[model samples]
Target: MSTDTSARWRLRAHAALGALVAALPAWASAAPRFADYPVPAIYQGRAAQPLLADAHSRNYATRLRDAATEKPDFAGRYVLATWGCGASCTMSAAIDAKTGTVTWLPFTVCCWDADVEDHLEYKLNSRLLIVHGARNEQGGGTHYYQFNGKRFAEIRTPPRHAPHPPGDHQ
Candidate 1:
């Protein structure tokens, strides 16, 4: 195609995509938020022993068990245990405080350049989790997920934050 024709075609495609995105339902396009998925209530029961049935959980049993002994730090009744696998690499699992079941985050996060103390962001009374860094060294960016008592479901349309200025890694 000629240069001018290609330019017009590209513009039309961009417009079409924008229109389609604007038509999506609020829940489909809106970012996943902690407040939106609040825990039913704060957990008051005693923390259960960490169960290590899955291969991943079994591999990290010691760490998982130790972390699970602490009070719930995620999703009201779950302890989100995180540990470093290597430099700048982190692996995480969620241990149910009410039950003893363990759930892994599917992939280890690494290859990030941020200056934060940790890459995982979560709260005790919220089901939302935000991971800062790459999942399995794929690409570096912020990722969001929501825990639904069993496993985490990643949110693909989380809001984007402006990039830090050059030379400022904080």
Candidate 2:
């Protein structure tokens, strides 16, 4: 082959190789896998059994709703769990009556193995906000948030309290 032809062929090969490398990350991110984590030992520990047992034995949804609405000074909390696609997850939420401060703990099982990118947003003066899930092994998810009477911007920072299970609802 001529030298100029050979050189052009090599340049095209290098360009093709570079393009393939650049496309790799985008392709990898397009699909992800979610792996379930072992249930927390706290749920199995002696001291924690009673608490877990109580949770298993009772349904407190009605009581929670009542407190949030009936009592002006009520600070309410609850946990909810569900099973899906052979896995289960939970979400919890709490609110302070006096300061109107809210806290939540959101988690999933068998959803993803990647970094947990949970973002919570609360409106400045309103109780409505949005929660965004980071790229997990399970792809990604988003949650619509609302607060008591007030609409507020969502805050990405962690809240002091860890919400249980039920509060994961959008």
Candidate 3:
């Protein structure tokens, strides 16, 4: 009778463990492929500038690479600062080596400010895709543009936040 009870507990434990493992979110390596990029051979516009492609497409990825290059073993991490625009404004995006889809991480509130200027920094992920169009202060008007391994879409941003303190915490 005791042996039978032990066996049942063990079986239940195993099932619970399996369920927990299945519920976990996938890691960057396991992230789903967002889109299929174009071949560089058919790339249009400016010549294939490998570094530029990564730098201009994403912000965080570019910062990580620059830090890593300047100082060995630079950590690929960043903080996002979203400037508040009164309904309808453009947002810049950035990608990382492990990032599948480019996420917009605006480094600066305004696009004009060079020091805190918001420029899209690109990095080599598996493939590259660009999302253009403005996002309202609340949320609306989202668009997407695709880039091969090279070439980036030109986007203009309206004045969203002031460049005084820098952080867009308002």
Candidate 4:
């Protein structure tokens, strides 16, 4: 190609690249960030420990501890502990910060799904824990649970709509 044609092509490529870079931040901002959730001071300096001394996770050796963002009125901070159960499964537990007791959450979530974005989320201002995904071909749905100071109890409410996973029928 001639020098002028090559220059024009380079200019067009540069313009396209600039447009892509400008749009990237907008796309990234729409996703959730770790800082968006509240973390208690206790979880900040402590290292992750075994979820339970006797309990076994599928393959992982330790459970990473995080502060439960909701229900601040409850005494000490309740910890949200999570670990990989297997290649596709993730297990979560609730650890009582004061008592050092761990309560295993009921469901095992899919770490990777081709059809939908499967994950767990805690509501900001309540004791509600939502598990979002398709479980054993039941179709995608959000399962709700309320932490009643002792254990997480599944609530019989309708599923709320979330952006990432489509076709939630429950």
Candidate No. with top lDDT: 1
Best by TM-score: 1
lDDT against true structure, model 2: 0.35
lDDT of 4 by residue, 35-109 (tens): 333334432323233245443532333342333332322213456666665776677767655544556676677
Better of 2 and 4 by TM-score: 4
**Candidate that beats the other on TM-score, 1 or 4, i.e. the better one:** 1
Q: Which 10-residue span in candidate 3 carries the lowest summed lDDT? A: 71-80
Q: Model 3, stretches more than 4 Å misplaced?
A: 1-15, 18-121, 128-134, 140-170
Instruction: List pairs with backbone clashes in candidate 1.
Output: none
Candidate 2 on 1-170: residue-level lDDT in tens? 99999999999999999999999866543311111111112111111111212342235344333333422221122112222323333333343333323333333334432343434433223333444442222444544344442332223323223232233322
Q: Cα deviation in Å at residue 139, candidate 4?
A: 5.0
Ranking by TM-score: 1, 4, 2, 3
Give candidate 2's TM-score.
0.25
lDDT of each candidate versus the true structure: 0.79, 0.35, 0.32, 0.53
TM-score of every candidate relative to the true structure: 0.73, 0.25, 0.23, 0.47
lDDT of 1 by residue, 50-105 (tens): 88887867778899989988999888889888889998788888999889889889
Which runs in model 1 stand beyond 4 Å of their true positions? 1-31, 157-170
Instruction: Tell me the RMSD of model 3 versus the true structure.
Output: 14.2
Candidate 2 Cα misplacement greater than 4 A, ranges? 32-170
Predicted structure 3, TM vs. truth: 0.23
Query: Could you arrange the candidates by lDDT from highest to lowest?
Result: 1, 4, 2, 3
lDDT winner, 1 or 2: 1
